[model samples]
Target: MAKGLNRSKLAGCAALAFATLFAGAASADGTVNIYSYRQPDIIKPVLDAFTAETGVKTEVLFLDKGLEDRILAEGQNSPADVILTVDISRLTNAKAKGVTQALDDATVNANLPAEYRDPEGHWFGVTKRARVLYASKDRVKETAITYAELADPKWKGKICMRSGQHDYNLGLFSAAIAHWGPEKTEEWMKGLKANLARKPDGGDRPQAKAIFAGECDLALGNTYYVGLMRTNEKEPEEKEWGNAINVVFPTFENGGTHVNISGAALAKNAPNRDNAVKLIQFLSSHKAQQVYAAQTYEYPVEPGLEPSDVVKAFGTLNADTLSLDEIAKNRKAASEMVDRVGLDDGPSS
Candidate 1:
């Protein structure tokens, strides 16, 4: 009788253990995995909020470069459910590489503007940042400037910029090519090259720093870097660099200012497809949009959402209406024009 009782108790314990293992597996399956080019710190708050609200866990893999390549290498077995990245080049490149898939969700379409999302639903823009001029407060007095004006001889030896091949400049140059044919764009590139303050070197913030040191009177930089600089309590010198310049919104002759985006795409082989869709929808929501604007200092892609006060102070952004698809199409031509015209060889070359 004692032996029978012992066997029954052992069977009960075995069943309980099996139930716990099954529950753990189910819980693990509910997690959404992400591969991102964006820094982990920038997106953590939103991801944390998502977990809290939906009880769906998130796992992020951050990389500074080669995000799409990694996903491609992982192939059908890739654990990536979502992809977060910045710039139209990266977004379109991921599509071209066949690492991203289309997402045709009503919630996403409603939350983001059509112009900001891929027409075929391959990717969606979550935030925008304008590529604007940073003019030294003591040097440049012009409040209004045109993109064509950058090539004028009057500003010779007064401009500073990063590598012409960089994605940011390529995006702007691509927009220029979209506005004007390659011939005219090349000529404009030559003229702009003639006006460079120095060889194309450093990132946007360094260009601002050059202006602060009076090395150049004007510099090309993104809108958000200015906000980052202005609010950088940890780096006091950068704050001074922010204060040394005035943000100038430059437009194409017949268009508005050039703007780029930080966007997301659904992975081609998403394991947790439904959870990934939910995360993408969550990102486009007003709540997530607000968090992006406040944390990244970027303009929200959502129609009614406002940018952070720091960004608002920079001046209004009249973003050009050129389709990002058009820009992506022109990127190769724009890049060829850059190398052919020797734009990166500096003014002296």
Candidate 2:
């Protein structure tokens, strides 16, 4: 496991970037500067291995938010060579922001699937997490469910999920748009909203907690949260939440489950462009995917790389054939649908 840099060092992005200006990691061979939206602990081992393998150390500035904005603000003077972040929506948004440049890496192209990488080569998915249902094991008996079924009246006021506007849900919502078209997706959103247990709130883990508490019978969340809850040490009771629910990789009536990725892109003004490309290529390699899978319990984007045992136990993810770029294209509309349907307002009393 990798240790995280001090959270205090993460306070002010510009100040931290300035502090590490010249004396950051790497040797005379030069280092790759990364501005990551992902927390440090999760990616440190992968970075350490990259440095060990290529002798190119990485200086990472971990930020909870504002990654693209910072890069845009720094313009060509930005020291960042790579942007590591979660969610395909964020990656695409970064590209839309014009802070990321198109990459031209043969290694990355060969290692990752077309649907998982931008056609322009701006970003590539390293790990994927499926959006699956968390159904109560005690109260729910059906082994199978589809994404559209969440709108069924039988489940009315019985579904629990976070905000529909959240990136995870938005990604799934966008997929709905891709599959059903905007008008039908809007109706689906209305149906889904009519089935909510309460005003959408909290992270994915809380939905599991709500299930355990008997507040709801089904929830929507990513596959990894189950593995994390099952293995939680800081909160032993979280294990009960895992025990209370079973994962269902919900498919569309005609397709598969909606999934998202934690991917990375090349900075438009990267000072260490070659080194950055090397690091990005390394992330798609089998070795890095293995470490990434075990550490975060996310599925590897590279074909033939298996997920951790914990993730597999959730059930096989039949990922939808819709391209994530297509999903990304619908996100703004998806978000608008959430508000149009008042999904966060909860089901009618």
Candidate 3:
């Protein structure tokens, strides 16, 4: 019943228990193993609730990078039963790397929208987060904006963002390539690079800090970070950063807001397959979805569930209907475009 465990402690516990936890064969031992890219704090509550209700024990191995490579290297002996990660790129990458297996469950299919889950059943999105514009409240007044508009000359020298090569930006860039052709998307990348307030330097929260400090007038960030920042008791300044800007939902010209997901997949060599399936199914249920909304401030994947009140304060999310599979397909090209433009080199370059 531990709550709010940090990543380091979680990792330590996982390491200690790794050997004994999976010594038995893949049987119904009333336990499930998870390899997760999500931070320990964000997912701990939901996992705890699952165990409380289902009486099935859970063990987690949390890693920031190389989750797929680790699982791949382990092959059939990998102890992982489920993989939890964020963004379409990572999910699709896991599937491509042969680390994930298809999940063909009727309940899971019914719980999530077709666009949010893999068309072939390789992965399932558990929560949705929009890639949004964080505009300086005092300096910018526009209430509505478009993704194409981020490259407009008007925003030059006033935009802050992370590296163009970051997965979050890549997700949006891939969506841009989907909405606009590759040719048009390349030109847009150049425009956005030219608009950089500084070299893409930090995570999404730092972009908000830049806006708050008057270093930039706008920035690109995911919606959940706003809630996380605004409610952060551990860091009072993040609350200020959250308050300094307004969340503007940006859309493709012919589409709705670009959205990404925090999703889960079945490990290819899952030791506890049935329990793993049950865990994923429970995560897709209304109760688990509610924990996601309350604890993480993310939009639940289950239809009809509203996001937390803090997230609701931002605005309704009219998520674009474009299939994530389509967006993921363009990631390689989008990444190439980032390098071609030298987007990480800053605007003055």
TM-score of each: 0.91, 0.93, 0.92
**Candidate 3 lDDT score at position 95:** 97
Candidate 1 TM-score over all chains jointly: 0.91
> On residues 160-248, what C-alpha lDDT tens digit does candidate 2 reach at each position?
99988899999999999889999998888888888898989999999999999999999999888889899998999999999899998
State in Å the error of residue 269, model 3.
Answer: 1.4
Sort every candidate by lDDT, greatest first.
3, 1, 2
Candidate 1 structure quality by residue, lDDT tens digits, 142-211: 9998888999999999999999999999999999999988889899999999999899999999999999
Worst 10 residues of 2 by lDDT: 1-10
Model 2 TM-score on a 0 to 1 scale: 0.93
lDDT of 3 by residue, 1-349 (tens): 3555676577555644553456563454898988899988889999999999999988888998999977765667678999999999999999999998998999998888899999988899999899999999999999999998989999989999998899999999999999999999999889999988889999999999999999999999999999989999999999999999999999888659999999999999898899999999998989999898678788988777888889899998888989999999999999999999999999998
Please list the C-alpha lDDT of all candidates, in the order they appear. 0.90, 0.87, 0.90
